[model samples]
Target: MDTLQILSEQGVLGSTPTVRLQGEALDLSSYARTEDAEHLRSLYSDMFLVRRFDQESTALQRQGQLALWVPLTGQEGAQIGSGRALERQDYAFPTYREHGVAFTRGVEPAELLRLFRGVTNGGWDPRKSNFHLYTLVLAAQCLHAVGYAMGLQRDQLADPSLPPAASIAYFGDGASSEGDVHESMVFAASFKAPVVFFCQNNQWAISVPATVQTSVPLAQRAEGYGFPGIRVDGNDVIAVEAVTRWALEHARSGKGPVLIEAYTYRMSAHTTADDPTKYRLSRDELEWKARDPLLRLETYLRSAGLADDAFFEGLDTRARAAATELRESVRSMQSADLEDRFAAVYAEPHPLVQEELAFFREYEAGFIDDGQHS
Candidate 1:
């Protein structure tokens, strides 16, 4: 099968929606095949809380608390879904804006906020949660993922008694245009590395729509590079989790890499700095809002009789509390000192860095506060 590649009458891949590209009707409940309603309800609660965390972080940025904020308001489904699918052994390499996944992986929201607040490059230890530091260089982390998977292959070869592990690289539709992502795919497939290339096709790369990126579906691009690929309704958390779980298992079980193109929409601006209204159509916005992931999940929960008014109200209450806690945590993050700017660069200080540090210290000493003596 050609797998669900849609093209415009004018020769575009997204001219019309395919069965695999349907908005919110993917029926993940069918695929999961479990009746643990409470667990699913908990998933809904976590998703809601993460969305609130995302909003609060954005507000923090606007309030001069954070230097920059990469909003993931519309990407909660893909992030939380895939995040929920991973095993503790699996490692995640994420680009910036993966706040939901970080939350799912047990990263403290305040710690992640530090990166945006300019207090530190990253506040948490990636090894602690198998969640790698956020890579800000577009698609650079794709290469890191492939390299880590290669190491996994090597370690397994070196120790025949070891179990398998998978590594996942999270990137946006825009990062797909980077050479590093493609190169990472090439290497992952050639070596049969245990890696899952999770591409969130949120329809726009900054201001550029996927239409300008490629002619075929993003997921199917894996086939050409020697791996199986699947497209899922990214807004449907069930579908994303199920598909991602299967892909990760396949890779860990020696089936090599899998490319998952999550057909989602970026409902908000690309970042707090960019204006989506300048690049996107109002109709597109309306369409995506109708297909909102959180709302769709809410619908399914209600229709499935797993949720009610009180449940939603309670969730809202919990979300508010969580957001308040996160805000407070951000407020408590310690400001970095001038010396810290030079630390962590090397195990031991280098000559030039030492010189720069000395110069900076002298510069600071020159600016004495009115009556203070140093």
Candidate 2:
């Protein structure tokens, strides 16, 4: 089936989407196929943890522990679902907002917070974690992911005995419009790079609506670069996980890149500084709120008899503890020395850099040695 054609038929005025994921408009019974009661309970636990982390990060930002916080108040399904789909051998490139994904991948929450808090560029090594440094530049990670996938292909060639490694690039709907993203698609397709371009179409790019970014669905654009595209109910964690797992397997098996557009809403302001109300209609907000990811999971869990008051209470307790721990960690992140930033930019210090560092060391010593603000 042509996935692009499937997308074209979706989101049209007054037209029903053929792929109505479980729990889109009905009770939680529909979501039962994806998991048994035990697994559902675990996923709910995961969602709670992610939300707790998000709330703590936000509070830290407001309290001056972090320089900024990009909250994913309503998009936990997309991140956790897509993240859970990745194999340990697979690589992932993430945009800055994918804290939930990082969390699912076992990234230490403290390390992620330190990046936004401005204590470091990236606190963790990408190679060690199976995750790349969070890309603040929109769509740049797409190119990096493509390069990584190509390198994986070369490695597979050098050692024909080795298994192929899939790469996943996470980007937003706004980033889908970037030229580098398009170039990434071109290169991935041309090289048959084993990559999945996972786009979280959260329906807003700060103040810009998805309508303004492109007339067609972002997933359909994958056809232009000779890749299949699948649009899933992003709020439905089951749907997102099922679709991403399928897409990732296809890519890993040498089918090249697949664009999985998880159709979700951006429930929060774009960032701490963004006022979504300035540009978004209240009606749209209300409509999207009704599709809240956590609510859906809650409904499903209750209907399936997978979660009870005890379950919820346990989750709440864990969430609270996590938040407290995260708060402390954010507070404890020590500021890096200013010189360390310049030191890592080169292998051996160049002559000019040596001279500048020497001058700065002396110049800085003249001032108070406390590196509090530096």
Candidate 3:
């Protein structure tokens, strides 16, 4: 299906939309709420800041300050748009690379590094932001999100006055192949859970291409589960937000879950430990770069005269400052006590935990005479 995109290649909204859903000319154009120049500007600012944050975090990993880093260099639009689309009561289950979503959920940039720095058990408190800690276990969060959505149903039934809420599961094309996604969809469809399955099809899952995951578009899978599905131009931030807002509304309004495939690209390595140059062609990267999410938004904003040079300049300065502050924060961070780390491994203390803590203590004791590992 043609991806739903409000903006054309040059960042101008198309006069006619050719996108389709269920074999119908999909005109979700009215879903876009970016007509207000200020809202569009805010979206641009979020993407710009997220891009800078991603760059700075990658640099930290390269410099040995972080144990590892997941790059989100090319997914600013998909993340920020959908993230901003979430209501305050909604919850998000994210993968490790969702720094852009974390930013939208009010997660401090430096706090995200605490885990990679090995300084804390987790980066941030999920309850504070309603954005869960990054899940590294593939599509496991998809199931968690569905369960949480079901709980939302129970909560509403109990209180009847509580604010309506939904859940969103952010996974990738690679994780879409996991059985967890299938099970989650089954349960969500069966229970009419309020959740949105958001797949950021960056095309590669580590070294594997998305083609290996599915022959058809990932969004189309929602049909078998008995819900609506749509493929949106993940590079178009406005379009993403619009689609996500509609999905969230559908989910919480007693309808079944929706599946959203954000068709975008990953401009960097899968992680600091990955080397995309080994698998992808440079020319392909160049072509996608032209469809850069930030560039299109900037183009639209400028052409419409929504923002001036001073506004962009201010954003640039803020981006640099944010990066600088994050670097300082990471450099100053200290690891938590080894005991604390072991304690957080499980909800309850176990013999294995004790054995591991004991081993660590013995190892540290061996280094008592010398400031080096035994």
Candidate 4:
């Protein structure tokens, strides 16, 4: 199992990154080097902006402006590259930490914060963006993605005019161990569903290291499912984008599902409530920091002269302004009325739920009338 790596730069700054292709990754090399420096620059810009947005979100949680936050500091390469691989018709189902992917899908920074701010159950419309809501329930989105992909298959067969599309399910190494993931894969393989299981193997599942979860490379598991599995350098954004494009193409062509293991690391605490100090070593953090996705891509850009100090400076300015705007949106978010909550409990209003809402409203009125607001 040779890991596919393209921009593994141990070379000094300002030197062009050597493309390292291993295994059967030769086909992906051309895609990685599009000769369009501006494309690479755009990838860097997205990484920079998303990282800034992620940092601001963490700060919001610290300042008590958000109820909680899932930080995607280190996995920007995997998220952004795979996200951009999607065609306009392709749909994506994401786990909770896919804020980087959301940015690629045109989800606003303020929209991404609304859920953590406790102002909304869904941050954005899945139909509008074709990017589903972040599934907080671990690997559950795997099943949903497969079902949706099967539906897409049927939809295309029924109407040849519809564009052929695939679905990509984003989960983590930890979620791979869940039975729900296995079950989803079973159905996908049996039906040859047009789906790509994009696993961002971020080393640890909360406090538990990935070593405790699986003995083999997570990509190897796809072999049992009778599909191609490729492990790519998740920190190398170019490699990730190339590999994901291939996987999406394979699935859409009716070659069955493909599992892509994006071998990356999580630089931040799993969430705002997590404390990495309790379980991980400072040395590990330093080592992964050296392989930081944004830094690696930034080196490639500088070496290629694709961007300059002025461009980066401008991006920083824009990111700061965007964060400020997101903060204001969070602050201005008002809690939803309790009546709306009851209405959402069912597709149609239930008698019992209606009675509960009425009783609660009447009980609240007692405090206001008696001048005993609490």
Candidate 3 accuracy as TM-score? 0.94
Candidate 3 lDDT over 6-64, as tens digits, reads 33323234544344454455666677775677888999999999999888998999899
Give the residue spans of candidate 2 off by over 4 A. Answer: 1-33, 351-374
Q: What is the per-residue lDDT of model 4 for residues 1-374, given as tens digits with 9 covering 90 to 100?
A: 12236332221222333323233434565456557788888998999999999999999999999999999999999999998889989999999999988888898889988889887788789898899999989899999999999999999999989988999999999999999999999999999999999999888999999888898778878988888888777887887898888889989999989998888899999999999999999998998899898998787677778889998999999988988888888889887888887788899979999999999999888778457686
The model with the greater TM-score, 1 or 2, is 1
Q: Candidate 1: which pairs clash?
A: 6-13, 8-12
List where candidate 4 sits over 4 angstroms from the true fold. Answer: 1-26, 355-372
| Candidate 2 local lDDT, 48-88, one digit each (tens) | 89888888877788888777889898888888888887888
lDDT of 1: 0.82
Better model by TM-score: candidate 1 vs candidate 3: 3
Per-residue CA lDDT of model 1 for 83-107, tens digit only, reads 9999998999999988889988999
| Number of clashing residue pairs, candidate 1 | 2
Error of 2 at 86 (Å): 0.5
Instruction: Give the Cα lDDT of each candidate.
Output: 0.82, 0.80, 0.88, 0.86
